[model samples]
Target: NAGIAATMPALDYPLAHWQLTMAVNVTAPFLIAQHTLRAMRRKQWGRIVNVASISGVRAGTGRLGYGTSKAALIALTRQFAIEAAEWGVTVNAIAPGPVDTPLIRGMHGGSTAGTYASMLPMRRYGTTAEIAHAVSFLASEQAGYITGHSLAVDGGFLASGLLVRDLFEPAASAPS
Candidate 1:
């Protein structure tokens, strides 16, 4: 998925950026759609599910460039959806939070070292299968009514900004 790279935009040598991320995140899919939709014009049906990231919805510290890129990618999804709708090619994005993937390993050494693994209500990293399930459903015939939507598969992490611990009542101690 090219993760962070896929979400950001381009700048000059002044920016010191990665083209793979920008192209995969923004341009390549658009071009693919351009070509595929051309073929699907008469056929009048297709689906484009862009794998966006949680960065698109909320920015974290020290991720300005990457986060900004994803925000742009979300906009691109909407724009493409508008253009492709008449052709029956519904364009949408899936913004996943911290899923357990090798990309995180590359960025943060190990899964334990990654951000918010223990903090999550699930107390574990999201599995690839979980994300794949969402994508599979998105690709199915049942998801025809859905488009221009950015679904979050982040294990309910984003729903609550603050974590509230459940406290237990003190058990009675025998007289010592």
Candidate 2:
């Protein structure tokens, strides 16, 4: 569970940023799994919970690199789950929405938080503890049957369709 919110328009996006995002968000997890799976396979029981983001499940402004990497991370989780299931290992992801973290505060503008709160069904950001609870559940023995799943810890962000009244407005429109 690693990531970098590299926000940039498609045209202005840099290859370096893309590579770095992939390296941290995707490749790092892949490598960690590669190194650890063998041991878990030997034990016939293990849990691997990855940290994904709502950005992966739903597109957003200036999230080209971040979103793409997270999407890849989700796919990678599925692939690993399929192979590791027989070994009693679970590979899952936790896609958190806007959580109250330093990283998020740094990424979001002054009004961005208020706008997101308005859009979310819960009308608030999630806490790190909430996300941790989800991860803990997936890692526990009770969740042995669950694998290859990207659980949304979002505050109904993924389930949302329309929240704003002015659908015609560009700001209220869906992300391009």
Candidate 3:
């Protein structure tokens, strides 16, 4: 989903922006699956991959519409997975973190880029190819057993917490 950022306080957030974002990020997936599922069901095999976002799992400072919409996409992936699994269809989602894409560059250019890097344990943004690799793996025959999973290609950002204690630790206490 190519979502537009409408960052604002809840009271100030535009309803149009929220609706538009949800339409693209959430509703489109449902529509696509609705149209495509019948063919896959006939074939008895299908791969439905939804590209969600970390914002969906963890709400950010000013991403009400984008986050909420992506959360819905993730939920949709699960619902579709349950209903489609018997037909040999695997529905999954990829929740990408800060990636070195035009979108990220546009959103976090200049010194602000470092702020996003610091939040992740990897201390860097992910690459588009890395995300593609994950998707490729999920789509592969070897991944047939995997379904309804939201894979985080986020360089550990989603699983990690702030390292406040690490900052105050002596050099010796730091992991090598």
The candidate maximizing lDDT is 2
Ranking by lDDT: 2, 3, 1
What TM-score, to 2 decimals, does candidate 3 have? Answer: 0.88
Q: Rate residue 43 of model 3 by lDDT.
A: 98
Task: Tell me the TM-score of each prediction against the true structure.
Answer: 0.77, 0.91, 0.88
> Which candidate, 2 or 3, would have the higher lDDT against the true structure?
2
Q: lDDT tens string, model 1, 67-169?
A: 6667777788888788878887777888887777788666545434433566565666678999888888887778887888888888776674412111113
The order of the candidates by TM-score, greatest first, is 2, 3, 1
Best model number under TM-score: 2
Residue-level lDDT tens digits of model 2 in 1-176: 66676666788998888899899999999999988999999999999999988778887767788888999999999999999999999999999888999887876668777876788899999999999999999999999999999999989988995232222245656778
Candidate 2 residue 10 Cα shift, in angstroms, is: 0.7
> How many backbone collisions does model 1 have?
5
Which ranges of candidate 1 are over 4 A from the true structure? 4-14, 18-20, 110-115, 162-176
Model 3: CA > 4 A from native: 162-176
